[model samples]
Target: MNDLLQTYTFLNQAMQSDSLLCLAQAVCWLDPLWRGYDEDFYHDPDGILSAALVVTRQLFPDLYVDAIDKLRQGATYATVDQLICEGISNTGIPLDNLEYLPYGIPLPAYGVELNDADFYTTHPEVIPILACFGISPEANPYHMTIPDCVYTAAEIIATDLAKRPEEQYQQVAWGLLWLTSATNNSICDWDAELMMEVEPLAWETNDLAFARVMIEEADEIMGDVLTGLYWLTSEPAVMQAMQDNIHRIYKAIQKKGKNNDAPNIRLKWVDLAICPE
Candidate 1:
């Protein structure tokens, strides 16, 4: 465990510098036995490292596929995604078929494909950062919270905020911003629900920098959510789930402020029926 921890530490700092080299080294270090050990490892310390690798791969597609090819040949580079897929296929785990794994239904339709230029124009802000991760703006960022994408993204972000509470608020806040500004449908809601599960540590010892970033981002997102004020077209249950989550997030940020020096993050849900003119 200590060896794994140290390797992750080195990788984390390395990621701040040369991401590809760090990814290559981490993938090499996380031999198949350790990575493929079990499903639980994905949630443990290893989760953070695994997500870094996934994001790293996203940024460098050629490197990601090359690493995947290498790991597949080796016995130790098993992915939690592949394992879950295998269990669903081979074992009777009550999991959905691969096609329906992200949500228990078939994938939702994303209409009217656009070229990269047009797509980026549609989502000017989000595409650049996502592009750095190798996800074309054309690809859906909305999938970030789905089960298939969560282990690699949502949960990883959650874990990062938890262990490093000073940054938790900002992380969650930025996550919300990305969710609403960039994602389509219930995706942002999904990210918020996952993020709301983690409890932020007290403000005294936590890093104020991360918290500030989170607050700034959340404030921006709230503005957008309130201003756009569009009704969703997904199933009522899904939409309700998202609304309930929005309420929870609204309350959580309010509660955190009352309890600590955490930033006052407000979410204003507008009532369109009664417009003030």
Candidate 2:
């Protein structure tokens, strides 16, 4: 477990560097079992390394992929780096071009196609560094909590804040937008219970994050119910589930902040009402 953690830390630093050499080191250090493990490794409970790898792949696509490919082909971790250097020496991609800050979701891009409310329930702000990647919906900065992402990301946020807490917090923002829809007979008659409920729309937020929140002292949002927040079309109801999930992440951050000299958690909800007019 300690070795895995060391690897996870090294991997985090390497990706943060966003440098090619570090990328090589990061990929070269993966455990063989995990190095060549299939995608299901993500579902496994021991996915500490998985979340970091997911972000690292995005940070250094070419070299990371090269190293992983070589590892799968039986190259030792120690040699894969040299093999990659020998194979192709292209200049590394600079992630500085990406903006980690998240912005309002542009529903038009996806056609506001929320026949199912799940369409708008998305959390791209989870990784603020990803904002440097792109603002379009496709470049969503978030990774599914997967039980690992939130904890991992929160740790990153807390630790990173130590160096420049002010800016680190500014870089990443966590936003949750949940969408659940149903066919409405008459738009604004929700009190009459006139709409047909839509099946669960994943859209955003968590399972683990939600669990974290429920256990904490969330007296503020206790009365909160549904969060679908808009009416004209989807009539996204404002429900407790989404609010609860976001709060849970806040609690997790606070729990992790024990290490931070001054842990100031910044939690925000993604308002889906920004939909197309």
Candidate 3:
């Protein structure tokens, strides 16, 4: 089996026994929070970060475990809050510095195309697992369905914030997006109804402080994500565009800050994408 499938199988077995919860909790506690309402984190960033953490520890335990321990020693809701403030406070780091080796989610060969059935047939065990979440796997070879199993497995090890009902729904929504991104070779129509659960939870929450912490922690933990997803946070234009979605939560619901973060993030993007390599 490919290393990616091997790791997934291991995690799958572990989840079946519910033995991985502690480790999942440990990562959630130590790493940044992915807010449910925030599409950037829940939809793509959180899953990327979680997959990076899970894979890094699985592949290089000493390096990742030690990092987690150290981060935990100093981690808190407040420290992470500061990190996001720092991210927003300054132009922030370049996207390249944030990039990491891409993780396993099989892609099609160059110039080749794959449909949903291709993924399901290749991984026969995935269909039923995903069905548990009401996300059916029925697309064709031209349209690959993201087996719900992946999201279900991911949620098993998701950040603590995902435990919140609103956040949990958002994470699921994000999980949908994450799967599509990983399968970049194919296109899937994302479910828009999922946002209904996310917006209200993100906006109605009594905990802006928690949301702030999730953002900051997401900033720090993702700074070194093994998956190349740091681009979501590092590239100014792309990151800003996504972050703008977060601020939209602010506008559509809270109507607070002036979305100053977007332009500043854009400046950071140019520096990363155009400046010296």
Candidate 4:
């Protein structure tokens, strides 16, 4: 981090709070907020910082703004007291230096790709996390390799979907699968099993009222996701097949129910449905 900031020149200066320090303090804030939002923390510097800026600005605008000004002017203190001092007492982050590493989220251990103009145009949400981590992306594989970053990206999908009104369920579910072409493996990757709920097949037909048939059939359409044939996030045929199958299933469920609103019945929870390990 010191090496990276040294390269930035301005960011490295001693405002003792805003630029480097403020970002450091942001880790303390951001580390928990993601979980509160959806319990998924991606740990990408760009996303985390972006979120931190939103949160800190709202919570402590005066102190945060002051820190930014100081960092801009390269302000410094003579005493160099512990972080528990008045500079950032409200956050209750314990330390003298920004060397703490146990937040589970990390500074970019690998090198960062500086100043990606495309990042804003392509993934503006990421600009903030990278800035907080004191870096940016546009390199290969990218922050997706980082476990926390991976988790964050996946969670942002369902991301507190449960918090939303049940009305948007059908549309969000269909649109997401249409764009993403997720399979059982993808669900495991995203733990989207949590997001998913299979309506009990209305008992009108000879089939079990379980979603096992629908998921299995849809997964078959996805064609061997386990062997990596269609393993990536988005496959055109794969996603479309899933979307089509979902429509079929919903129609079937509605027909069985003999009503427009199929009950949101889940025969078995995902963990229970999984074969005993």
Best by lDDT: 1
| 47-151: candidate 1 lDDT, tens digit per residue | 533543343243334434544455555524345345434433332222232333322211111222222245456655544333322346445544332222212
| lDDT string, candidate 4, 1-277, tens digits | 6877776776445545367677766765534333343212222343433343333344445654554444335454222222113443333322233222122211111112223254345545434333332244555433433323222222333233323444232233323332233323332223223233322222122232233344444444333322222222223343343334334444455456645433342221112123221
RMSD (CA, angstroms), candidate 3: 27.4
Q: Per-residue error at 11 for model 2, in Å?
A: 40
Candidate 2 global TM-score:
0.15
Global lDDT for candidate 3?
A: 0.36
Candidate 1: which stretches are off by over 4 Å?
Answer: 1-119, 138-147, 167-169, 176-277
Q: By lDDT, rank the candidates, best first.
A: 1, 3, 4, 2
Worst 10 residues of 1 by lDDT: 105-114
Over 4 Å off, model 4: 1-233, 257-277
Minimum summed lDDT over a 10-residue window in model 4 is located at 104-113
Q: Which stretches of candidate 2 lie over 4 Å from their true place?
A: 1-52, 80-277
lDDT of 3 by residue, 1-277 (tens): 8999999999877766784786776556555433222325333353443443443444434444544554457564334334332332232211121122232221112111123455556645434433433345464345554443333333332332234344323333343334433322221222223322233212112333443444454443323231333323333453343334334333333332443231211111123334422
Worst 10 residues of 2 by lDDT: 101-110
TM-score, model 4 to reference: 0.18
- The digit string of per-residue lDDT tens for model 2 on 125-190 reads 222322211122343424321233333343443343234323212222111111111111112112
Q: Residue 59, candidate 4: how far off, in angstroms? A: 11
